[model samples]
Target: MATTVRRTSITLPAARLGPENPLPALRTPADPHQVDERERVRFPPGMARRIGYAPLRSLLPVRRLDGYDRHRTPTDLEAIVIENDRLRATVLPGLGGRVYSLVHKSTGRELLYRNPVVQPANFGLANAWFSGGIEWNIGATGHTTLSCAPVHAARVPAPDGGEMLRLWEWERLRDLPFQVDLWLPEAAEFLLVGVRIRNPHQRAAPVYWWSGIAVPESPDTRVIAPADEAWHFGHERSLRRVPVPEWQGADRTYPLRGERAADYFYEVPDAARKWITALDGEGHGLVQTSTDLLRGRKLFLWGNGPAGQRWQRWLTEPGTDGYIEIQAGLARTQLEHIRLEATSELCWLEAYGPLAADPAAVHGTDWTAARDAVSRGLEAALPRSDVERAYQAWLGCADTEPKEILATGSGWGALEVLHGRFDLPGTPFDEATLGEEQRPWVELLHNGRLPQGPLSTPPGPTLVAPHWRDLLETAPADALAEYHLGVAQWHAGDRAQAVRSWERSLKTAESCWVMRCLAVADVESGHPKRAAERYLRAFELAAEDPGQAHAVLAGLAREAVPALLAAARAGDAGALLGALPVSVRERGRFRLMGAQVLLAQGEVREARAVFDAGFEVDDLGEGEETLSDTWFAIAERLVAGAGPVTESIRRRARAEHPLPDAYNFGL
Candidate 1:
């Protein structure tokens, strides 16, 4: 079926480019309603600028009164014009500072802007010299540091007939002392930004820091970091990876198939690579970590997450872009296999910024030499090779599983160490496969021993008792009654309940069983604030009895520092200080944390005094070596400003002999 086609030329009148009359029909529908709600309408000059100057599209504008939804329409947009200058003032309290503000705007929604200090007042659309831009709400609470106040957006027209337009502007803020105004243009294509740091307190303040960039999830976002290696820690039976999904489709290795909960840490030591790209398959994508890239600086990575804990699978898979994260710390592999002090120093990281720059043009410092040294130091510190050799030696001596299991546990100290690190891999024996004669074999397998058979099954019942507590709650009690009950609660994910149950078990007639349960649960659920107390309590109860002490102490040592770090980041000073032992060495960390709080509180001299006094404390274990590095970095940052402190710390720590390993905490 062929159809005839006719062509005719029609001419339209030219019009002035203003808010009232835009381009003729060659342009998109001038009336906004003609476009679908989701489909954005486009106009002249601005549209050309969006396509030619700013390649990216801005989100539709909506008033705050509309709630957390996207902004749509020019009328909904707002710029905080200061109504009163006297009403807005800054306050420097001890804990991070405070900003108080009040303003009015044409937009219907309430703007909750917060910062550590420097509050901005809102003004309606009036043109005023004291105009304070939009307020940024930081954290769960709306506390934000008013180091940078972003206002004014130049709207670029959309080319593809979409509602999204590009914004271009030049911003200047007070927080960044040495840096000049950043060159972020409002056109969707360019974002030149500047930072401002305003410290009102007499004593210099340490700004607790992390950069947050929020971009909508789209199919175009592809996360990338310039790093040589990635590592992660064990979480339950799972193996976690720090770089997250290395490539787009490496989902097979993850535990929960199709589960898109992506969260992990990463470390990128290479500064040569500037920006990590998140490409939208549709040619519109975002590049991040560019602020550092623009300045030719390395990304500083710091985060507190699961370390040493084991889980079933490492990453979560999202078919499309759900979220991609890059962190500045030990990757899951390094975090798992190497100590933080040794492996973590080499990392540089990046986060969200933009995607338009030549990788070669980005200024960078070569960190390979330092990274290699860090790698070697970490390998030197690891017990992996030694453990492997020990396992080989033990195998050479004993051919029989039954004899080997008994001998290893009841063997020499070195052999026991070997046995702990290298466990034989195999599936657990099914109850159906066990005969009366095989009960002893089953018992050995259940208790985390290598079994001998064509079917060298490692019994899950014994090794994973805690994971199955819920199933066994109603089961009858035997010698393992209280122990099994506590394990069940632990396995069932009631950590608090598991701890309580384990404590209850200690009062049972079977002290040995109760002690074992208590030891494991205490580490898993004990709060850092409660850790030292419980550990001491557990030790005292087990004083005449040593089994509980060994197990609980090991667990406590492994879990305590990390728990303290978590507590510290979450702003729990009591938990941070309380986790430390009463000994002088532990007091160093307590004092250091106190200093951090003091610094946050704007008590510079007092905080310094606390650090100075605490550093004099006697060393308890090699664990303090890592703490020393943190202190050194903090001191140097305060004294010399933030730069390369890793080298200084490494040199200093090495000058001190016998690095802390007394704690023997793997994380």
Candidate 2:
């Protein structure tokens, strides 16, 4: 009769999100930090200012989670269900609070792309992400670092006197706390989600929020939005304005029309109702509309190119239909960041439900008519004023404290709560949730210094936020405190101070972890040789510990050998690779590096054989072209045979090689 919330479990063949990589990710993201200022597009000056604001220099303090492998086993995942008569929504609290499945009950149709398996891929900011359903992306560009992370979930009062599922987490990048509240009213077709992002700091913060909804895609489906044009961004790394629905001699609205993956940010007029839809040939599909504050909408598709098709298979289990993303955000494009003022929060209400439009109109050549028909349908189903009214109703209920705890997320939020003395009512990051990871930081907060530990033992995770950095700065100097202090200074862009702190830490104790930190600084400072030397030394020290785990050895090698190769010390890299445990050297990442070493040593054929033998880097970063690049390099060497190569010769080499799909993650 009314909406209900319940905790449950779903069994799926899921890959293990293994332990986080102990190596600090010192390099900045491959993606550019800012939108190219040269691009000519007309935007209100206020909007333009927000777009060019603060962007992340590096995802520091957040380490890579690349220890996972491709092997998966049937496992039970905790889920939260919110249901009424017409809709049933299943939320996975453990995995970024992703809405795993949304069913339109009457027709027995799954409205979202319910992923058949929990396969983790290297798509997020922190290297591990998954495909399927609806995901809330926060923090900076790329998929949120929380893609496979747990978010605190609890039961709260709903606007319509029903139960609401609240999901909240401390977004590390911008140091903000955000919450997502999901509920459905009695007999309502649409699911209501109220989202809020709070800026607790004294100064302004750059906020990025994109609610990515993955709907089932098909050859006949066409995405429609209330805009005549869109800002198109493609694999070519450029952005330009293009007509909506039809572009580049094809109806770009259809996900399969293009040959490569792309993002289409619809230029929704300020006064227009914010909505986007993807309906099939028969005119029934999902529509997502949000209140005006969530101003931007987008369509992202893995087009019908070979790489795109291959990527779809790589991200999921075999024999399943793929999906396209319809996303909503605060800025006009994903590249831009919106400025959230100090002590203020941004709130918006979004509705997702099935929409039925005229098949002829939806699939017609007239883009305006198709979009208008869908917008009118959305209005008839749930009017803009009603959505606004719902937001007002939600605000009153949003502060109502949780009735019960459904699930628990990371202790990072609670650590922030304790540090800042935040007064978050409805979404409480309780002190009880603080665990082993936050234990040291908790001590640093209540006590004066970071607890000292043996140099042989790896350091715990670092905190680089201004508040934590201040504490680390005031703490008594020691190897433990100085090492973490360097990380914080580096995050703040004080490279000189970071180097000084690490060098001083070395006097107190010799640590591979601190040496690795210094090596990262060396690399950033353009001293590749110095970096290589430090990396090699770090690995040597780490190797001296006979009782160390294989993973530690493998992880250190993964960082060191790359630096050695970068410095043109391939011989040293080869020796390091040889020193690895046989099992470690055989891993895809090390094997790939080994092939590079062979190529450098003039053993081109041997390098080529490694590619021919076939291997997969399960932890490869998204858009990393190393696999295909190395493949082509070997092919070119074999073709030239110690001769001077020309462009045509390169072309011939590639023609002969014809990189396999397994290695072609180029886009």
lDDT of each: 0.27, 0.88
| Best candidate according to TM-score | 2
- lDDT tens digits, residues 1-667, model 1? 1111111222212111111100000101111101122222332233222223211111101011000111112221122111221111111111111112221122221111222111111110110001111222221111122222222121111212211111111111111111111111112222222222223212332221222222223333333345543333222223223333433454211222223223333434434423333333332233333223122211111112221111110111113112222222111111111111211111122222223222222211233332333233323432234323422432232211121110000111112123233222111112333344334324333453223221111111222222123234544443344444554455445657756655655554434334434544444454545544443443344333433323233233333334434444323433434443444124333455556555554455665566555352211221123454444444554553334546765565355422233212222
Model 2 bad stretches (over 4 Å): 32-35, 40-47
Model 1, runs deviating above 4 Å: 1-481, 494-504, 510-536, 543-551, 554-610, 613-667
Who wins the lDDT comparison?
2
Clashes of each: 67, 0
Clash pairs (backbone) in predicted model 2: none
Clashes of 2: 0
Tell me the deviation in Å of residue 346 in model 1: 32
